[model samples]
Target: LIKITYPGLLLEEILSTIAGNCLLCVTKLDFSAPKSLE
Candidate 1:
């Protein structure tokens, strides 16, 4: 049904956004860390 599909699609979108933000944060941290320490 349209109603069920709508919520599922919204959930997927939210999850994708969260995942993208997490990845970006990790990438920034990776670049900021010292090579000798890592």
Candidate 2:
């Protein structure tokens, strides 16, 4: 059971990291975009 579960947990961690990075990038873009447009 431990072996089977380990890969799923690792995959979740990787996915969460990627999602967090994407959110950070999007937030940065949202913050900067209007200033550039104006």
Candidate 3:
């Protein structure tokens, strides 16, 4: 296994940032999808 350190973006910060970005993308997609497709 390999280990590394992030002085700026810690593990929790990275995870939450990714989750937040995904949530935003999902919400936008939800808003963009056509009603006929639902």
Every candidate's lDDT? 0.87, 0.91, 0.77
User: Could you say which candidate leads in lDDT?
Assistant: 2
TM-score of 3: 0.64
Candidate 1 versus the native: TM-score?
A: 0.73
- What's the CA error at residue 33 for candidate 1, in Å? 0.5
Give TM-scores for every candidate, taking all chains together and pairing residue i with residue i: 0.73, 0.78, 0.64
Model 3 lDDT tens row, 1-38:
12256545567788889999999999988888866487
Top TM-score model: 2
lDDT of 3: 0.77
Model 1 misses residue 38 by how many Å? Answer: 11
lDDT for position 6 in model 2: 98
Per-prediction count of colliding residue pairs?
0, 0, 0
Write model 2 residue lDDT over 1-38, tens digit each, in one string.
86476988878888999999999999999989999999
Our tally of clashes for model 1 stands at 0
Ranking by TM-score: 2, 1, 3
